[model samples]
Target chain A: MKKLFLPFLIILLLTSCRHRLVPMIGMDSNGDEVIEHVSAVNFKSSSADVMNLVAKDTLTTLSNHKFNSGWDMNHFQVGLLINTTVGPLAWKVSATPGFRLVFKKVKK
Target chain B: MKSIILIISLITSATLFASSTLPTDWYQPSFDKGANQNTLSTPSAQADEEIDHLFSTQHKTLKRLNKNANKKWKVTDYVFMLALSKSGLLGFKALNGKSVFQVYYQKKKATPVKVEESKPIDIFVHEDMTDSDLQAQIEPVLGALVATKKIDRNTTLSGDIVERINSVKQVVGNLEASTDKKFYLSAFRIDLGINSSGILLPSWAAHKGTEVVLRLQWTRIVKKGAPKALAYKSKVNSNFQAFTESVLKDLNKIDESPLASTGKKAVKVRIGMGVTTTDAIIISSAKTTFMGNLIFKRNKKYKPSKSVVTNDYQYVIDKSIDGAKKMGQISNERFIKGLNKAVKMGGYFVRKADNSKKWKVSMLRAWYILSVQGFMGLAPITATSEIELFYK
Candidate 1:
């Protein structure tokens, strides 16, 4: 039982804490590249900080007419993974401003 | 830090109270507790049924026809299609002040069946797929056709074929000719698949309960002598396969994520992002992707001009920032690292009819991924300033 402990611990570490590369892109808006709105949600019962990274800049810019704006988009479509989190502190810690936004284009 | 926490709590409480009158489940949160409320997941029951029907019917039939050599082979035309449902609403993400992703599907046309045209055709289901592996699964379709006397063993087969591999097919190398007929094998063994738009995100698969189809079309072949036929018919468009533009990056650009180098046409880029409501289990946001043609343009000078150049790509707000690197400059540095000489010449992502225009350097890629979480669990967030630039 003692010998198996080391081996099992190593195996668990190997499988559980592996890093994954998600196919993410720069969702850089054309204008207003600042943190238009930012809020942090902490669940007292669960003890997790879910920082809301809300940049509601794209909505006002897109053409409202469906045909011209993006005739192609007609649904809410995004990829989902079972056991993956976004960042280093994703779903784990309650750090201040889980992410720091430095918008080079936006004037402070 | 205390101020930040207090501010967050204050805002959250106020927002909760504002929507207090609504039902608790109205804006349900928490991934484990409920089904994903995103656009892709809501009508999933209908999506699942439609997808199953397609697989059971059209896909099965295509596999069957690829087998039984006795059955007449129509000219192969494969199409890839993505459709978006007019939902009750695109949940919170689509409805909020955020743009969404677009899904493109290959158009389905009424196939013209030539009843008296007894010309037998042998569909070479791309050189990559093995006959034995697929034969058994779709055998029933052919068996039913033959049993009903739709086609017989003695029917003359037209050796004429159409390969529906996605890339632009060009017959490059050797040719072996029979006394009456001639056969020419294409040079590159192009392997590709269906995609999320042009982005090969995953295997362009249909979720368990939704419908997305990759279809192959067979065209009527006009047999004009061997030499003339070989001269005119170089390659046919095989629109959609199981893999796509991004998967090609699987073996080579193993480090590159979100983008798979699926097709070998030219150096192209697919930019996308996602947003969700309650569950991360189900995709609650559209993979809003856009294909930008960088390398392969009929007009060479106009290609990848702005997307790769740093100066031309600055957004209006870009200059005011103290130390902001231009999106183009970032894209240039990262993309140049992965791009080889070939994509420098070939890979170009363009619209079906508008491959002539010069590529633009815009901050927003038409679709915006907006992630907003309220009412359950730790709320959601959305950010996309880091793009994984992939090349082949």
Candidate 2:
């Protein structure tokens, strides 16, 4: 029972491991999930300021049909996928305003 | 600075740990009603919303595209014509404007009919058409309006009915032999005009305007009713003929020409009959030929100076008959005679005969082609025919 428990714990830890972060920045015209913009960006850290700014710009341009002095950011599914085949490193995030960043978190 | 760095690192670690366990609750203003709370959904509702937004945003662009398509349809409005014949017929295009599409129909399919768009079409049934057959041919086109309904089916033709259509007789082409040339009498001249008219007159107050003129060059073969064959001694000579001219002289001036010397200066208009050559086969075998041209002119304007118009028109008639066949049956012969008779008959309705001029009967050069079928003894047969006209 102890050995079975250890294997289950390992599986859970592996599934929960942090791999990458992506920042998506664009919005649907009606505040829908559909992303509408010229392009988007990807990032490893949610804290990446550049990713957020680009995402915001993309959303602002798409919804309002004009670029904003400040960045416009809206959250959308974009093309996000999390399943059995793809590892965490395969995760991608994208933003518009002409920027994309792909990075994997340093595994602890 | 050290404390601040440690604080940021701790915050990052905690955030990562949270994300690894569960993704962020993505901001969706559209879901304020808790519409998509439990499941991570790429909702179909979201796709519809995006499409609706696009339509609303580019509303003007799509509207213009629709308008352009409609305008294109207007130019080609006359996609079909319901009634047609050698003389004329009424055509209605459900989509056309006020313009009458004048399409010229050929007896043979080889001839091209001219279609005039944007002109008020003059609808006419040849005078020879029996009231019954005319109705049959026209009923389907007119939505059976003539027969099925109680509405007035009266139609005033463009020119006087050239001739009542005789289903028994076929119209002919006789630009060839002199006698065969004289059949087409001068129909009314059509002066094509652009939109609208010059006057609005009450039906009661009558007035006269300067006469609009027309000319015809045709040939006629003198036949005692209908000829059976191309024989030289065919009863053609028994028909009395007149080659008349209508000269519209000033009602107030003294007559100048020899026709006026007889104390009548009114322009002389007369209809005559004569003959020229028959078909080549007939001419080769017989002692005589069967043809003549019936020249119809505005006698008042006939002069030597305007001969250029004469030359050009003669050229047109000559070129028109290069490959036409020679002989046909009585149907073609009668039509030519009927057309000539209609001119004389219809002209009397418009003006009085001026009894004051010396008249001359002469023939002109032209050709003929046989056309149409004559119904005889319950069988329809083609007739020998000719077409002729006068220039100047």
Candidate 3:
């Protein structure tokens, strides 16, 4: 039991130190470097409604980064995925100042 | 001094780690190249070639018909006769062992028939034949017939009497023998005379025969340029068909790939910030992941699953379809405008006739027959068709 405990302790430490890469949610146009954060929301929403929620969520994300001095939050792209028990509903919204919002509903 | 240096190095390393860093493979932004972005190039050159082929075939038919004739007719003269024959304008009935020529004029709103007759002459007038030329041909025969008292001085002579006097019955006999259909030659030329006020007026107008007036009006319509208009109408129709087919083919290719099914079970919003380029924020979402609190601060790399990439491509195609729909509307408007212009150009004679109001109605009918009806028949190639073809 003493010999088994030593091996288990080493395995636990190694597993805990393992570096895991987070899923990327934002990137530059060229996609060289990316910033990643997990954002989750639960509600009944449509492609149009998701646009407003995405706007608020983006502001919250930028505020968390603390390097928001030069970034233009108004002009950005948001891809929303609504997971239902039946299937996933995907939508992309591009928000540019003075330009009309273009909503694209992605088919599964 | 050694302790201070170690502390400074540690603080600098911590600051660098907190700032932006190169993305790992799992988090690399995959740029969607999108669907084809080329402008639609219609086969106009091919359509023009088709029009030329059509005209050449018609010209060949005209030449063949003239070559087989005993007396060759001018293009306009042949067209006028063909129009009259096809329109069923010339009707004949046997009366007292002699064939009497009856003229039928078809009006869409009203049909009024009247019958009357006098002398006969088979006059072959070409497109260049003027009123004076027709008068010159008729005056000598009428003067001789009136002087001899065979016909009254004031009586309007028809083609039958002139055929009898000139012994030109062979011309009429040849025309009847050339075709299976029998046509009684009853063409007339109105004599010009001075009225009470010294104004020169057609004697037929003085007679005021509705049958004669209607026949002459129809003849005028055929002679003024219906043949050229007919040729142009055929050309426009073929071109429009070719263009419509080409546009439909292009639109169908827009969403050809079948959408891949995602087996994801949860909604995940992944917000990303560009470390090196801070111009804008990127937000992406997926259905399988629920790691909302996870952040990638290390330099470790890992490849994303195939389903994630496929989902991104689906979004790209959706965006592309939206853009193509807008372009389709613009091109459709342009095509319709061009079609209208061609129609108006082809129907120039009908629109500019002396009885324009009456002919304009005919022009509208022709427009409907040539374009509107044809377009409606091809309504399946429109937006609804696009949606069905693309989605299904």
lDDT of each: 0.21, 0.22, 0.22
Interface RMSD (Å) of model 1?
Answer: 20.2
Chain B superposition TM-score per model: 0.18, 0.18, 0.16
Name the lDDT value of residue B275 in candidate 3: 9
lDDT of 3 by residue, B73-158 (tens): 11111110000011111101111211111111111122222211222323443323444665676577556645554335444344
Per-prediction DockQ: 0.01, 0.01, 0.01
Native contacts conserved, per model = 0.00, 0.00, 0.00
**Candidate 1, A1-108: lDDT as tens digits:** 999999999998876444211111111233211111111121111111111111111221221434343233221111111111234433322212111111112123
Of candidates 3 and 1, the better by TM-score: 1
Q: What is the Å distance of residue B376 in model 3 from its true position?
A: 8.9
Q: How well does model 3 score by local distance difference test? A: 0.22
Model 3's DockQ score:
0.01
Per-residue C-alpha lDDT of model 2 across residues A1-108, encoded as one tens digit per residue: 998999999887775443211211111223222111211122223213333343344434444543243432221211111111123343233222222111222234
Pick out the ten consecutive residues of candidate 1 chain B with the lowest summed lDDT.
B1-10
- Chain A TM-score for candidate 2 is 0.22
Q: What's the lDDT for residue A105 in model 3?
A: 28
Kindly state the fnat score of candidate 2. 0.00
**Candidate 3: which stretches are off by over 4 Å?**
A1-108, B1-43, B71-366, B369-392
TM-score of each: 0.17, 0.16, 0.14
Write the residue-wise lDDT of candidate 1 on B227-267 in tens digits: 43333223211111111112222213222222234232222
